[model samples]
Target: MSDTGLHPGLVRPRPQRRRARSRTYSATVRTLGPLALLVLWWAASATGLLTPDVLASPAEVLRAIGELWGNGQLPDALTTSLTRSALGLLIGLAAGLVLGITTGFTRLGDELLDSSIQTLRTIPFLSLVPLFMVWFGINETAKILLIAVATTFPMYVSTSSGVRSTDPELIEAMRSFGMGRLALVREVVLPGALPSLLAGLRLSMTLSVIALIAAEEINATAGIGYLMSQAQSYARTDILAVCILVYGLLGLTADVVVRLLERLLMPWRTPQGATR
Candidate 1:
């Protein structure tokens, strides 16, 4: 009898032990962890570690969200923020892809734009909010532009790096096949750079949101950022805390959505580093 293969789980009891440990670890992280933090927070609040007027407990934030939901302002705020973020993301991504691909492949373009972009990235995004306000005014245009400008550099850097990092063997194979320049870029470079592009996009979203807040606090009538600013003016720390929480959740949601997209687009990849 020739017994050829055994599953790792069948070959050794250790795999089952490892599986159990993994599940237990995940459960501990997901279930018990946040509850423990919540208790610590409540204890601190009770002990006056935080002034209730200036800071909020988790329960207060939840209550504030519930009140906003009941009042129908939450959805409006969400819509405004999401629309601005989406428009900025689209425009920024389009320009970044072009700039990155061009600069990555051309010595002339790299020499010209690389240092300029690096220098631009060194400047904090919030510094540009006032400048954007002066140039574009305090309309939706200004907010959208602020987000776009803030987001562009991350994508640009990631795109260039991703293009440069395309597997040399793959590029060699494509050249060996006598593919044209455009064909090589289309078939190899863009696809190879998607993971890094997504990562850049994730970073861009964070910057975009922060920029949105700084902009909306100036002239916007609606948005989570606008709402947060309003809450701040009224000294409603709980409401402001909830807005911050919502921002965190939204950021996490975007990341998860991008991760799912990466898995779908790069099915051949292993668990780690599949997108790039």
Candidate 2:
């Protein structure tokens, strides 16, 4: 038999070719799945399979978005929501980082706070709505605090886990160099924990967005959630869909931002499944 025909079915591509194919497959699915779903949604809406009052069509949503923009309602709602989320996120991040570091690095701190935090994190943050409403009054403070509360646990947990998982040998080496508490953490611990911190940030931000929506929906008069509530009252599914999509896009944007930050801060870290 000729060499080319002897084992044609047995030929395997090179490793590079395999990786390229894997990446291509991953990208294709990520793109195509959303596109396919969009097409299906459009088809269903057009065929009346999805009732307008229940699920607005993409075109209706677009029109609603345009109308909101023209009337400046969307911009005001967006600003209000973003302001609340931003304030809450900053406060949550600061508290979580401080608490995480204290408990992560000190037995005394851990003994004093870790158990309580772990226990508290078990309860759904949303369950605090009634209590918050009573204490904070259905004001922006309550909504912002709700977002802060929802976001804190993820960051704290991830940071603690990351700190605990740092290499013992590396830590010992740092200690041998007469590294003080501040230097040790600044130089070694924080860098080691960057991945987990960023991961937690992503989760926390996403949760904050969700909590903001819930908080606003309950008693808001000037945010995206309030707009959504009004839309519901008016039976405007298109406006509701627009708000939902905006929330999704904001979450997606946050995730992408965190991923970019991770790449920027951890240049030495290996990309998953890529050859060094």
State candidate 2's TM-score.
0.88
What are the models' TM-scores?
A: 0.81, 0.88
Candidate with top TM-score is 2
**Candidate that would win on lDDT:** 2
lDDT against the true structure, each candidate: 0.80, 0.88
lDDT (Cα, tens digit) per residue for candidate 2, span 1-276 = 447665555764556443334556666766897799899999999999999978999999999999999999999999999999999998888888888988998889999999999999999988999999999998889999989999999999999888888898998999998999899889999988988999889999999889888888667889899899899899999999999998998898898888778779987775575532
Looking at candidate 2, the ten consecutive residues that score lowest on lDDT are: 12-21
**Where in model 2 is the C-alpha error above 4 Å?**
1-17, 21-29, 268-276
RMSD of each: 6.3, 4.2
Which portions of model 1 miss their true places by more than 4 Å? 1-33, 46-51, 172-178, 268-276
